[model samples]
Target: MDKIKIDIMYLFGASGHGKVIAEIAETCGIVIDGFIDCDDNKKSVLGYPVFKELPSTTESLVVAIGDNGIRKKIVDNNIDAKYPIIIHKMSTVSKRTLLGAGTVIMAGATINVDVNIGQQCIINTNASVDHDCLIEDYVHLSPNVALAGNVTIGEGTHVGIGVCIIQGIRIGKWCTIGAGAVIIRDIPDGCTVVGNPGKIIRKMND
Candidate 1:
């Protein structure tokens, strides 16, 4: 059988996250060119060569790092040239879901019916976005994050890992939710929330 031509990409990190991204890419029929990382010791991961510099032949990049703050930084550094692919071969995204450009959906992520995901958003591993969820531009839903039905997440909002957002909650734009936060009520724009039941621990300082 003739091999299918696919988008060539390199994952930015070579840890567990990188392997997960590579697996997703494989499932999506994408060709992984290599893995790139600053750590020199990661010369090879899962049989793919490690690259300290960007791959000259590849056009797409996948930021496989899990940390949101660090991931943002990595994205900012790499996005100067290469286009990043938002891959989610195992994701159950509805036909009604609107996925924006430059978004990356990793494996096991579920974008339910009528979910609106904005541009440059990162829907990471095992995250579930329920029906009628509105995710604005540049939002990052970390691993294991769950949003119930009818949740509205504003632009540039970063929902931390293992967060659980209840149904019908309207999270304002640019909010930062800490890990394991359980959002039960409506949160205003620009708030930084943490802990169970999600208190406004830090207001918009900037």
Candidate 2:
């Protein structure tokens, strides 16, 4: 069977994680256009050209950067959204797993065997997402954010860098977790949580 070909551009990352993004693209039978990186010393990675400027193309792009803030910054650029790309291959998704377009799964970010991750989610560097998890659209699992088995996450939620969610906990939509927060309970919708054990410090203005 012949696979459909798609062109994907990766931005805001280089080195090992970027290579993983490329690897997933290759595994999915997609072609990588190149990379856009902020690193000055890296002109290219694994033979793919790196640029300071994002090229004017409608082809979909995956933000492979590890930092949550940088990833958000890179995504702020306005671009045509007609062609959405998916970078997946090494992902251990079950047949039931549902992933939307323009998502980037970094190396060692596990989606479990039957997890459902939504569109444009950033399964960031070294994050461990366990089995049967349900992650909604635009969620950012920051670097090292660990979700135990069966966790249910709301849409557009930002799990902070190194935040740990216990098994089966439900995190509300558009919630923000501070760096290193440990989530042991359900968080209400539209809130910001922080500290060793996460607590809602302020409600979201929206």
Candidate 3:
């Protein structure tokens, strides 16, 4: 969807993450119609009404949940909803970068030239994605995470807060890089990595 055409939008998931997205939307001067959540007990969020079901409207919708798996599930189920790329006003995204639908770039994030971020991905606050980075669908780069040039993060992978990845590293799908990890080597799929050199402690399904 065209970002410029977004006048009013709705956010799915009425939680803390949703609140952050609301602030980003507001900062971008986009009017939020309301929030949609599965929780019946949630009546409102950030002064906006919350509905149990998505409203039938032409406005765009943003999946505001922070969990990669849950966000992917919601996007898959809501195939008809228009998903737009939500970039915070304070983010520094190069015009040469390509951001996929349903992706959210938080404040203070820096995405450099030729970066391609996939659908439903989260480039969290203050995260720095250097040039030529490829971030696949449903991936989350937590706050203050730093990726050097030519890094590739696979689908559904989560890089924890303050993690630093060296240049030309390829991290595989569904892997978890723990907080403060310094990745100096390639990571295989489905692994849980931690420590300074990013050792794989265990497989995700272990």
Q: How much lDDT does each candidate structure score?
A: 0.81, 0.74, 0.92
lDDT of 3 at 140: 97
Task: Please provide, for model 1 over 5-71, each residue's C-alpha lDDT reduced to its tens digit, 9 standing for 90 to 100.
Answer: 4466678889987887777766766677899988978899989999998866766777777654566
Model 1 residue 173 distance off true place after TM-score fit, in angstroms: 3.9
TM-scores for every candidate against the unseen true structure: 0.80, 0.68, 0.94
Q: Poorest 10 consecutive residues of model 3 by lDDT?
A: 1-10
The sequence of per-residue lDDT tens digits that candidate 3 reaches over residues 138-198 is 9999999999999999999999999999999999999999999999999999999999988
Candidate 3, which segments miss by more than 4 Å at Cα?
1-8
In candidate 2, stretches whose alpha carbon ends up further than 4 angstroms from where it belongs are: 1-5, 8-30, 35-57, 63-91
Among these predictions, the greatest TM-score belongs to 3
- Top lDDT model: 3
Which of the two candidates, 2 or 3, achieves a greater lDDT against the reference?
A: 3
Colliding residue pairs in candidate 3: none
